[model samples]
Target chain A: MAKRPLILVTNDDGITAPGIRTLISIMNTIGDVVVVAPDSPQSAMGHAITINAILHVEKVTIDDGPQTEYSCSGTPADCVKLGVREILDRKPDLCVSGINHGSNSSVNVIYSGTMSAALEAGIESIPAIGFSLLDYNWNANFEHCKSFVKTIAENVIKNGLPKDVVLNVNIPNITKNEIKGIKVCRQARANWEEKFDKRTNPMGRDYFWLTGEFVNMDKGEDTDEYALANHYISVVPVQFDLTAHHAIQQLNTWEFNS
Target chain B: MAKRPLILVTNDDGITAPGIRTLISIMNTIGDVVVVAPDSPQSAMGHAITINAILHVEKVTIDDGPQTEYSCSGTPADCVKLGVREILDRKPDLCVSGINHGSNSSVNVIYSGTMSAALEAGIESIPAIGFSLLDYNWNANFEHCKSFVKTIAENVIKNGLPKDVVLNVNIPNITKNEIKGIKVCRQARANWEEKFDKRTNPMGRDYFWLTGEFVNMDKGEDTDEYALANHYISVVPVQFDLTAHHAIQQLNTWEFNS
Candidate 1:
């Protein structure tokens, strides 16, 4: 029999979140799992890393499982860096993040700690994937998406991801039977229209709560937003090479010397 | 007389950092400046937005400048969000983040709070640019790049940026006379080879301080890394779309079932 793949599992929702626990259990059925995740919730951390502070990592067993787990006092991106460098004996065959509590579709990917972990792994030349459920509830049902998750992971392991690329998979908050298979899509053109809720504390200083409404401006059927809206598991092949190649030519045309 | 443009200035390196002070002075030469930046150093914050905590914004007078300034207890991205949504009376004509104390070239762009502020503005359909110097010191001399910075900002204001794109500009830590002209380049293919400095804490627990050496793997002359190494100011057009469009067709061929 072939040796099982070594899977480095992580998430932005912290080590104890149900999202990662479900991801761990599923990976166990397919590979040797080692989880190095954040010690506390790091939602929407983007690709932030702890550069100014020291990081504390401790081994913990949240539940009875075969997977080895270590929680780090850092962001999701820091967890991946530590996992790949300090914790793991060798490079992982696959690094999977999330099973995130909410969607990382379209513009949300830029703000996602879940996707950032996966992107960090990809930058290290590791084939990685970040998974997110459309549901935001802590007790959201993940049972319906297990088979689909397993299938996607299996496929990724069998056929390695392209260089500089990682997968951003967002599942609709629908039953397993309702999922219309998977769709390979691009990120939609979207943004959050920020609305700050200003209030004064007892100290008489005004503070603002970050609040926003996500607005999808793209009507493209080939976008992840379209796929998820149609009850399909959207798989957007995400890249960290943020260079806008097409814009480069146009930028070159402008004379810098006045 | 044409109304002077309104330019929103911000940075990852706290409100009083010399980088932003230099940036403010340059913008003041070209437009009406409003400075909304973090109260403390927020380097390497990536695209993080303060969602879990309440943000405090206070009016500050860092120096005897004509610019209106506000310091916020949030990440660089949060400063831009708050600036546009809550602080500014109207959408500014342009947004500029950083004359950063360090380089955000190559893959470093993903880990940069300076660039994140610019990207956040781009998402809001505002023309934006992130400027970084090759030096890392708090008092790094930004004087040498003043003319270049002015030229670039003026060019950006004259020729509005493409929709959904921002500029990542890096200047070499060399004298003005030695500096080559600006070059529009792609993001280099490179990443940090992370080395976590493991140390035993006073409490007898192991802790780590993240350290890394940047490894440039790209040989392309059109890359930002190449431009900077050759003493040229590098400008890479960056987009937040994140989609790997080239990989989509290949991913579509994968079997999602069985």
Candidate 2:
């Protein structure tokens, strides 16, 4: 028998999110799937790895599927660590994270629990990808994402992802038919124009809730933001290293003592 | 009166740690310092922020210094968010994070709370930096870091950090005199080989404590890893965008069928 591709599956929206279920269904069609993910929501956790506490992962049967699954008591990155280092008998052929319920484009990638899981796998030298939809709603339509997800996954399985690089795929929230072709792009020059909602607590103490308006500063039509707006599925290959190579030379020109 | 440079101070080791205390002491000499830091340790948190929970900022007196310090219940990113959004009366002239108890060079930058705080500030278009020492011990030597820290801070103040970039400065564990000059470098291509120590609880439940070995894959001497190894302070300018621009063109070559 031909060896089936062993695909490791995980997400930030927890084990029960429809997004992962959609991701799982796609993986099953392509490979022998093993799923490990957070049992509860871990959105916006970025790259948090559980170090201050102990992590517990218990096998759970969520759907009637051929895939073996485990639910973890940690962040999304924690699930990737548990999946590769403990759960899987050997390194999987590929690791795919998130048909995430929200966008991981532009600066959102830094705060994405979805991409963090994928970056964790990339750090472990595994080919990895993170998939997200521009929609943030839990009930956002994911059926349209199936083909793109499969196509991307198959491509990764066929042509290995670059070392230390992971894919950040953000699908436009429109219907599958309305979606244009996929566009490989760069992250947008964007940021949240944060407006803190200050309120008084029950104890009459001031507190704040993080709220913001999405501000796209880049007018370039080449970025992920532009691609998504043009209705294309934006695929940005992201690496874990946060270094700004250009600025290093600028720092070098400065005399530290002067 | 000459305007005092507005220095925003933060750290991943929490506002109370000696590392930040030492940093605060030094910043008092150069500028008007205002600290917005986490009340508890946020080590290894990466770029995580408080989204689901309400954020509370409580002003506290750590020690008598020129800086006014406030402790907040959030991750390192949140500290920067609060610092820029609410704490500071105006945009900071420069933002500085850490003097963290350990290294945040190479692959650690991706998983570092200290560096993430700096990156957060950079994202907000603020001149920013993150500093750390080679020692992970709580009582790690800070005396040696003085000259390097002062120099880097002064350089940033004088020349202003470039757009969309922050600096990750790693000092050797040796005394300030034994420390060689600073080197502007790239993040070493490296990662932690995760070794989870799985154990059974008293209830016979399985739990894992994340552990790892720092593995360097990049052989280039132009990296933070190599510079730190050679007893020089490594300054790796960092940014939030993780997009691999070189790989974008490569992934575009992949045939994706609808």
Candidate 3:
């Protein structure tokens, strides 16, 4: 019999979240699963690593399955680091992150712990994917996202991703039937209109809770936002080489005598 | 007279790093400078924020400069967020980060706290730039970096970067004379060949210090890595939009139902 593909699983929503539970079930059917994810939630932790603090890892059994699990006290990226280096016997055939609680669409990819895990894996030359849903709840309808996740994982197993690139797959918050097929798109030109909620602390010191309005300025129909709005799963093949090559020539025109 | 540009300054090498100090010095020449950077080094912190902690900003004075500085307990992204919504009086004319201790060239852009701080400003509709010196030390050469920083800041003040796009400026680790003119280049296709240095703690626990060899696979002459290699200041106009637009059609072809 052919060797089962070794799959490394992770998520930003923590090891206990239903999202990872569902994600694990799908991977069970695909390959030998090994999960190394954060012990608690690491939402919005964009590419953060635990350098300042001491890291702790515990052998965990979140569920009784064929897969082995280890809970890590670190960011999503840290989980991947542990999964690849310490836990797994070999480099994983694929590293999958999320079924994230919310969208990692457009500009969110930069601030997303979910996608960052995948990006970190991609940096290791591993074929990685981050799967997020449009929904933002703990008990989200991850059941609907299962089939799509398996399909993408299977496709990756068949045909490899581009070098130094990873798939950022975001599924709309809808039933599988209502969901339009996946659409590969570019990062949308969008931003968060800042609105900080300020309040006085018990000591009368001012503190602000970060909140905002997401404003999409890009009118281009060929964007992740556009694809998600049309009920399509957005698969942006994100590259780690963030060089804007097109702008290089324009920048060369500037004369810097100093 | 046109109001002194409200310049928000930040860095990944901590608020006390010579890089941010040099940045603040240059900003004082052009605008009403407000510094809100991490209190400690946050290198390789990408776009991480302080959602879990109640972020605090304290007034700090390190040098005799026109700029008002505030040290923050947050990442580079948090500094930008706190700068606009928590500290600064108004939206900045230009937000500049670093004179970073090390290079944020090539694929390092994706994993850069310096660029993320700038990207945060750009997300807030402010013109932003992230500057870095190829030297990585507590006392990297900032003397030669001054004029180039001033010139770039001046040009940014004169002609704004494209909407939603910020500039990532990387200077070679060389003297002013050895430095070639600045070249606007795309992010190079390159990555760090990561080697985690594992060590046993005093408590007999194992820990790893993330270290790496930067391997530039991109041979493009117009790449940021190439520009920096040739002793040229590399400036890549970076965008916050993380979408991969071209892949939508290709993803749509996949049969998720299958």
What are the per-residue Cα lDDT tens digits for candidate 1 across B58-109? 9999899899999999999999999999999999989999999999999999
Candidate 3 residue lDDT tens string, A173-213: 98888987877788887877767677889999866677778
Give model 3's DockQ, 2 decimals: 0.54
Candidate 1 chain B weakest lDDT stretch, 10 residues? B249-258
lDDT of 2 by residue, A1-258 (tens): 178999999999999999999999999999999999998999988889988899998999998999999999999899988898899999999999989998989889999999999998998889999999888899999999999999999999899987778999999989989988999889998998888899998899999999989899998888999999999999899987778877776777899744
Candidate 2: which pairs clash? B144-B176
Query: Cα lDDT for residue B194, model 2?
Result: 82
* Residue ranges of candidate 2 with Cα displaced over 4 Å: none
User: What's the TM-score of each model vs. the native?
Assistant: 0.99, 0.98, 0.93
Looking at model 3, give its docking quality level.
medium
Quote the RMSD, in angstroms, for model 3: 2.4
lDDT by residue (A1-258, candidate 1, tens digit) is 298899999999999999999999999999999999999999988899999999999999899989999999999999999999998989999999989999999999999999999999999999999999999999989998899899999999999998899999999999988888999999999999999999999999999999999999999999999999999999999999999999988998999843
lDDT of 2 at A61: 98
- The TM-score of candidate 1's chain A against the true chain A comes to 0.98
- Model 3 regions lying over 4 Å from their true place: A52-54, B202-204
